[model samples]
Target: MIALLLALGSSLAYGCADFLGGLGARKAHVLRTVMVAAPASLAIELLLWPVLGASFDPGAIGWGAASGVASAVAFALLYKTLALGPMNVLSPVTALVSAALPVGVGLIQGERLGTAGLLGLPLALIAVVLVSAGHGAGSSRPSRTALLLAFGAGAAIALQLVFLHQAPADSGVAPLIVGRAVSTAVTLTAAGVLRRRLGREKPAYAMSAAAGVLDSVANLLFLIAVRSGDLTVVAVITALYPVGTVLLARSVLAERIHRGQLVGLGTAAVAVSLLALTST
Candidate 1:
């Protein structure tokens, strides 16, 4: 029950972070937006280290660094795939693949689920796809390159979560600190390489920073939740983040929520309820 709550909190935070990040990206280059977000995330993690306590064990550094690399890859590929068009299809595909991989990993590692969990997991995966679905499919279908990038991005996302889970439990927030630092460096390097292409418009510093802070919080919660709960359950719950994003869009951006997403929201609630009941 505690883990379920933490995972749900993580999902909400992740959703909020993505919403803000999307807003920030609209005002400037994606790299530029990440430049701010990454540093902000690192700063928050550094602050968290003193409070949560940290140990830079080999497992912490190695797995954290691995997650950081996967994060960078996921960030780049995801944005590129979205830019290539047909976000409606590609976004859900990415989300589904990301959730599915971690679930598979957890099962292969000998995690067992009860009947309720078994039922809820598939519902949660389906909910992830439906909630991530958008209104338009864009004018053109996604190209082969876009499809490959989408798959790669999803795999990278899954790897990030798995690597984080692999970190030493005694390390506290040190893995997050290391991962954020590495991602920050990658963001800076990418920004440097593409400086000329970044354009002259003022970046949405506030929005980007807020996103970073929220993202750090989400990661912290996810790390804690995974440590205490089954990875299969926690991962599926976390992947429901798209529900938050879709709801936020409707309220803040006044974007219309489609029928599919509405059904997804309901399905996710039922899935979470079942999981919580079984956990109890």
Candidate 2:
């Protein structure tokens, strides 16, 4: 139950981070926005190390580095895929795949679930797709390349989460620190490579930094949650982050909540409730 709560907290943090990051990206190139965000994330992780304690064990360093690479891949592919247009099709697909892979991995690792959890898991996945639904389906489908990139981005995100989970328990926040460092380096490199194309628009440094801080918090919460709970449950609940993003959009941007999204929000509530009951 504590794990579920922590996972829910992580989901909310992730959602808020996405909302802020999206706002930052609107003001500058994605890579430029990430340039601010990534280093900010690393700074937060560094700050956390003293409070949380960390070990430099091989499992921690290796898995952390792997997750960092996966994260960099996810960031690049997701932005590229979204740039191709028809985000309505691609966003939900990415979210579903991101959530589904971890669930599948968890189950394959022999994690058992209660009957309620069994039912809730699939419902949670459905909610992920629904909540991530955009205002419209657009006039046409995403291109095959866009679809492939979305899948790749989702897979990379799943790998990041799975790798983080595979880190040694006693490693504490070491994996997060190492992962953030690597991702920060990757973001800086990408931004440097694309400097000519990034334009001269000033990035939303504050919002981007805020996003990074919240994202680091989300990752920390997820790591703690997964350490103490079933990965299947933790991953599914965390994937509900779109709920937070949608709500933030509606509140901050005065965006309308589509029927599909409304239904999805309700479905997510039910799924969380069922999972909660099972957790107890």
Candidate 3:
């Protein structure tokens, strides 16, 4: 139950982070935004180190670094996909695939659940699709390249999440530290390779920094959640992030609330309830 709550909290934090990241990306390239934001996020983690306390281990550092590399690929591809076409179509597809891969991995590991929990998975997936639905130009016509990139991004996201859990449990936040460090290094390399001029454009500091803080917190919470809960359930529940994104869009962006989104919000509530009730 506590783990489910942590996962839910992570989803909300991640949703807000994504919203801010997207907004900031509007002012600059997403890769550039990430480079600045990753260091900001890493700074936050460093500040928390004395309070949170962490033990270091080779295995944890290795897995954490791998997860970071995977996350780097995921975010780069995801933002590129967003730039290419309608987020309405692409976002949901990415979310569903990202989640389903982890669920499949959990099953392969012989993780089992009750019928109620099983039922909630599909409902949560439907919620993802509906919540990610948005009104954008050319949204109705998605490009093949965008679709492929979205799928690849989803897989990378899943890989990151799954590998993060592979870090030794006693290693504490060291894994997170390593992961963030790796992300920063990778993003810097990507920036150099692409000749992206970071901070040359007017920095959307407030939104970008807020995104960094929230995303770091979300990753910490996800680590805690996966340790205590079923991987599949935690991943699926956290994938409810699109619900928060939709709500934020409706309020902040003045986006029209689609009927399907409303239904998705309600279904997400039901799915969360069922999942929480059944999770060990």
Candidate 4:
């Protein structure tokens, strides 16, 4: 129960972070938005390190750094997609693909879900596709570029989680700090190379900061959740973070909430329940 709650909290926070990050990236350079959002992650991780009794593990740190690169790429692509339109389309596709990859990894490692969970898996995939279709297949609303970016983002997101789990058990929050640090450095370097104007970047700073805080918190919650729960279950729940983004778009951007999206959300809920029930 605790782990489930933690994962759900992480999902909500991740949704908010991604949505805000997308908003910030709408007018600012993508890398610049990442640079601005990275600090909150660093600061929060540092402050919580000793309190959480995190130990520094070199192996974990290395994995974290690697994951950070994946994370940076994922964020940039996702925000770029969201900035264009159809938060529902990209959010579900990215999340579903991200979740499915990890589940496949688990299976290859000899982890097996029960019959119910196995059923839920394909259902989740279907939901993801439905959400992506949104209005219809022929609408051409999201554009090929946005879909391509979302696909890349989803693959990167999977890579981020896969590497993150490679961290040693004792590493605690230290790996998170390393990951955030790497992400910041890489993004900042990219921003500098692009010669993005600092003046223009300034306008998005506030949104970027808020997103940083939310993403940092989400990362922490997910780390904790994974430690206490099955990776398959935890990943599935956290992947649902995109649902929050879709809802936020409806509330904030006044975008029409599609029936397909609602159906997808419902299917996700059922899928999570099935997975969780069978796990216990």
Candidate 5:
């Protein structure tokens, strides 16, 4: 029960960060946002380390680094897709795919579902769709390339979860910290190259750094949640981050929620209930 709550909290934080990062990227550069966010995340991690009393194994470091790379790629692509495609189409598609992979992997690894959990599956799907639904009632056409990139991002996200889950529990928070560092480095390097080509660097660099900090913190919370609970349940709850994204969009971006989104929210509530019931 406690783990599930932590996972849910992580999801909310992550969703807000993603939404804000996306907005920040639009106002600046994707790489820039990542660079800024990374260090902020690292600082938070460092601060929490003593309290968490987390330690890491060498193998955990490797896996964390790999997850970091995957995360960097995923966010880069996700932001790029958001820039090019409609939020309604891109967010849901990416989120659904991302959630599905871990669930599928868990099943393959022999994670069993109770009756409530089995029923919750569809609700989870509906919740994702609902939470990601946009207010663009008239926008129908979406770019194929953007959709493909979103799918790629989703795949990367799934891989991130898989690697995180595989990290040894005794490895403590080392994997997560290392993963954030690697992700931050990779994103900054990529941003540097892009900025050099475009002849613009300052603001972009700053933004990426800020975004990187938020990303790192979010990852740490997720790691803590996973360490304490079932990975499948934690992953699913965390993946429901779109709910936070939608709420933020409504407030900060003044974006309107459609009827579908309301339905989605309701469905998500049901899904959460189901997940809670099943986790027991």
Candidate 6:
């Protein structure tokens, strides 16, 4: 129960980070954002190290680094897609794909669901879709390229989650930190390349750095959650990070709440209830 709460908390924090990062990216360079945020994340991790009593095994470190690179790519692609496509179309599509992959993988790995949990699955899916729904009218049609990129970002996110789940439990938070470092480095490198090609990249870099820090913190919490709890439930709960994005849109972006989002939130509540009831 405690672990489950922690996992949910992690998801909420991550959602906030992603929301803020997205907003920040609009005003700054993704690479610069990542660069600035990476150090901030490192500092936070270092501060929490002794308290968490976390350490790293070589295997965990390697896997974590790989996960980081995947995550960095995922965020970069997601941001790019958002910049290019309508939020209404892109967000839900990417989110659905991302959430579905892990659920599918878990099922394949023989994670059985109870009746309530089975019911919860579809509701959770609806909740995610609703959460991803954006306010205001969007383009009548979205570009195929943007759609493809959104799906690709989803795949990258799935890979990151799976790899993180596979990291050694005993490695503590070191693997998480390593993963963040790798992600930060990769994003920064990509930013440099993009800047050279585009001839204007500072704002994007700054936004990416800020997003990276929040993402790092979220990743750390998620790692801790997975280490201490069932992966299936943890993944499901954490996947709901889009809820935070919706809330942010309402408060920060002054986007009106859609009926769909309210429904989604309600669905999530019921899904969570079902998960809790079924888990025991």
Q: Over the stretch 175-223, how does candidate 5's per-residue lDDT look in tens digits? A: 8878878887887788677775533534455445555555666677777
Candidate lDDT (C-alpha), each: 0.92, 0.92, 0.86, 0.78, 0.78, 0.77
Whichever of 4 and 6 has more lDDT, that candidate is 4
Provide the clash count, candidate 5. 23
Q: In the order shown, what is each candidate's alpha-carbon RMSD?
A: 1.1, 0.9, 1.8, 2.7, 2.3, 2.6
Clashes of 1: 0
Task: Return the TM-score for candidate 5, rounded to 2 decimals.
Answer: 0.90
Q: Candidate 6: worst 10 consecutive residues by lDDT?
A: 198-207
Sliding window of 10 residues with minimal summed lDDT for model 2 = 133-142
Ten-residue stretch with the least lDDT total in model 5: 198-207
Q: Mind sharing the TM-score for model 6?
A: 0.89
Residue 75's C-alpha lDDT in candidate 4? Answer: 72
Error of 4 at 228 (Å): 1.5
In model 5, the Cα lDDT at residue 10 comes to: 79
* Residue 121 alpha-carbon offset, candidate 5, angstroms: 2.1
Query: Relative to the unseen true structure, what is the C-alpha lDDT of residue 218 in candidate 3, on a scale of 0 to 100?
Result: 91
Ranking by TM-score: 2, 1, 3, 5, 6, 4
TM-score of each: 0.98, 0.98, 0.94, 0.88, 0.90, 0.89
Candidate 2, residue 43: how far the Cα is off, in Å: 1.1
Off by over 4 Å in 4: 79-92, 131-133, 141-150, 197-201
Stretches of candidate 1 off by over 4 Å are: 136-140
| Residue 228, candidate 5: alpha-carbon lDDT | 78
Q: How accurate is candidate 5 locally (lDDT)?
A: 0.78
